[model samples]
Target chain A: MKNNHPVDEEPPIEKPPFFNSWKGMYWLVLGNLAFMIALFYIITKIYE
Target chain B: MRPLDWIVLLGTIGFIVIYGIWKTRGSQDIEGYLKGDNSMKWWTIGLSIMATQASAITFLSTPGQAYEDGMRFVQFYFGLPIAMVIISVTVIPIFYKLNVYTAYEFLENRFDLKTRSLAALLFLVQRGLAAGITIYAPAIILSTMLGWSLTITNLVIGVVVIIYTMSGGSKAVSVTQKQQMAVMMGGMIIAGIMVVSYLPDNVGFGDAVAVAGKLGKMNVVDFNWDWKTSWDDRYNFWSGITGGLFLALSYFGTDQSQVARYLGGKSIGESRLGLLFNGLLKIPMQFMILFIGVMVFVFYQFNEPPVFFNEGTKSKLYATEHATELRTLEANYSSIFEEKKQAMQSLVSALKTEDEAAIAIAETKVENLNAAGKEVREEVKALITKAVPNAETKDTDYVFISFVMKYLPAGLVGLLLAVIFAAAMSSVASEMNALASTTVVDIYKRSINPNGSPMHYVNASKVLTIAWGIIAILFATFASMLDNLIQAVNIIGSIFYGTILGIFLVAFYFKRIKGNAVFFAAILAEVVVLYCFYFTEIAFLWFNVIGCVAVIVFGFILQTLIGKNEKELVKV
Candidate 1:
């Protein structure tokens, strides 16, 4: 059956240079956030 | 400012405006004018999104915030990356698939016309006012500090933004933002470097950081949890992650100004990449800006700092009945500054010695001296209020700019001023573009003239752009009455964003809820949000969470009631 919905037609997903997939890119972003939070926590402790 | 400063400032701003208009000269059709020919790359889109969000107030108020309140303000962005990822995974694909001109247009598809109009109207109200603030924030501060005409400053920013934005529309906004972002970041980075170099010969960067940490200026995170007090604490880890998440999601997902940025991308991938890039870099960019403010705090430790940062207000105090009281406060302030300076030096020396015991004692002394200095500053503020009842005595907004003008070299001063103007113009241009697009697409074309020719809609968009620009300028001219320009913008957004986000979230996720239920629920939710804002001490960020959840709960209840009514009628 042909789906008429444009969303289901899925546009081609180009992989970012460093990440293997969009999911990988998202994980990298989340990882970066975690790292930043940890680093900020350390900075707070060191300075406090 | 010197001749070199004027030349740099004017040359930079002039080049950006002319280049933008020239590059986007042929946007004759509605789609071309409103959506930028759908040709923006990931980097351009990313930078444009960032520039649109980082208004002049962000540049002016954030550093000042750090100077006064420490780096806890950085926590506010902790949820932004999460918001970005979620939007990329869900909202971007849907928006691209629908190919809607405005985010609100998607509401009409998922729900009903009334729902779409309601969300669009909320956005227009919040963003239209925000556009004015974007221009007014820098204008008020710059005019007072530089002794420029306030009217002229407002007109200069509004007119420059209107010209390119009205002429070339969204393409012009996106194209010019690339250059504006470059100038803003470049100017700020240079200012940061110059501030450190201008410090006393003995004070290196490491010493400055240590001194700032000792004085509590380097406080970047706070994990304390007290539910009773949490709602009032503006910038803590908990409020930031939860409330910040809701705010960011609503902002990036439902706000037309942001949706319009990604909507102009060439493809969904490009748009998603653009948003993800912003998520990756925004926090670090904010950290750098706040760190520069901390550097300014350190710079003042050695030098005699102003008792109040706003010199314009200070000059006014000289001619007032309380001038004698002001002089006494100034004398007390000077004495405290000397004591604080000595204590700071003692702390710096202790830090260098690597003796923990000495460092601890010096830290206590420095903190006490700093508190004394703050008490004198408070007295100055009280005297200013007495001298001029209507004056804005919170001078933190003037801290960084005052430092730049009085201390930086002449040409760099001009460049930094250009940075402020560029940030203001970039945000204002995007806002005008988005506001016009929404007014034309979601309101005018969708309802008033569904069959209007493409050319006619294009012209209408241009006219609406001019109209919004003028309205913004008028609003900015009178915006001086508002307190803390940055907070004012955010408070405005918070009041409306939650209800709007709730409506969209229902349409997206709650398939069982019908249009009537969600539309009425959004209205009720907005009223509740406003009630909380005006009556309670709940932090503004929590409004997003509250408003969103209220809509969902209300939607389900309304739907069930309607279902009961229908069943009863059938039995009858």
Candidate 2:
């Protein structure tokens, strides 16, 4: 069965999903945290 | 250097040329010539894109970078996969939808004629000069290492590339690139294995990494964000996401060299997949190359290497009066370097045992000793340069090739040389093709003759390819003057990529912005980016961010202000 949406209507703009969103600003913050955590882990391993 | 090796080198080169010409025999028209009649597959496009970006610089310098630094260089590519996904979804659909020849072609339709022209011109100048440097870079290595004349090396690179590029155009480039990529990957893997095999029997692969780790060559990732220090400039999360995004966007979305690669794709999905393929493979491929370099560094530590890696300069220096000074410096370097190597092994053992105090002691001594060894090597290299006035003394560029020559077997050496040649040829061929395409399509065909025959345009492209080939040779020869040829070309790109990207961004997003406003804004932004590059010490990567943002913000402001005034004045 066909949907009732108008043919000429503009499609909704999709947001970049929680992990990939916000000026990519949040993504940047989380990414830095992850990288630091990983780096420190490597350093600790290397030291050990 | 053996008869069989020579045979392999000549045979590989001969087959690529003949096969290329045979496959693309009748590609005489402009569309067939430049775009392979738009019938390439996804895998072919993916390989072609990889080949174009991985020039001889990748083979020659990346290992040197690894040997000097470590696997940390691999992090620079961390953002590439994500960048690829973004391009595939947003940028890919637009170009495919437009059915454009050059990426710049879409700018005219989206914005205005001037916008297209401005972007096209920027690509031409930057790419044309860079194409020369690529050709020149490999030639410098071949000539210096083989003790051949620079002129001969330059001509060989130019003539060999021109023959295939002019003969088969884009089709020849893509097909040959497939073979080239295979050979390059195979050769590098073998070279990496050979480095391990050449190690002392006591030092297995694990031990080598331990040795490398002790020497501080195993530090693959740096977390500190000290902006002022250029030495540890890892592609951080922010730079990778923001700057890398803009760079990938401008490069794939605008640059003709790359656009031409995908333009040959048969369908939109194929082209998009090809790009996605690159995004997947590039980071890991870079990691492998850097890892190979780390192994080379470990190999050198176990076996004493030359004071200066460039054998060409060492030979000339030995023949001169300054030989005595250089020899003394080398003797000093030999002893200190050995001690440093021992210190590295101790550090590794300390780390293995989880002895905190021993680790601290070993790390400090190892660092100090490593610093002293570097100082002595520099002093020796300086003496070598003083000994031979006219000799080219940059040894970092020669580190990998020197290893290849000293260690790799006879036939494998030829294969690796061919790999370097193939890498250089693939990149140079694409640049020549893209340069010709942009020249004929954007400037000549549009402005000079809007209705020229395909035959006529094809002929013009061949002529332009040869002309640019000559230009590249000249650039390649002089490229030695620059401290690092790879960095020099990249610096040039950083200056122009952002503004061009900005213009493209405005065309895609700013629906209300017209061509003239964006075009002028591009000009203004380019000047500012250049000023930042010259006057400021901001790392070259940051320039991409500055250029892209400046153009977008400036274009919008100019567009809105002019747009509003025009409407108000019209009402009056």
Return the top candidate by TM-score.
Answer: 1
Cα displacement (Å) at residue B204, model 2: 2.1
- In order, the B-chain TM-scores come to 0.98, 0.95
- Give a tens-digit lDDT track for model 2, residues B28-102: 677778888777877889999999989998899889888887766666555556666666667767887887788
Give the winner by DockQ.
1
In the predicted model 1, the residue pairs found to clash are none
Candidate 1 local Cα displacement, residue B491, angstroms? 0.8
- Provide the TM-score for each candidate, comma-separated: 0.97, 0.90
**Candidate 2, residues A1-48: lDDT per residue as tens digits?**
222323423322233224344335334433543564376348525723
Off by over 4 Å in 2: A1-48, B226-235, B340-365, B384-393
Deviation in Å, model 1, residue A19 alpha carbon = 2.3
* Clashing pairs for predicted structure model 2, backbone only: B132-B472, B136-B476
In angstroms, how far off is B503's CA in candidate 1?
0.9
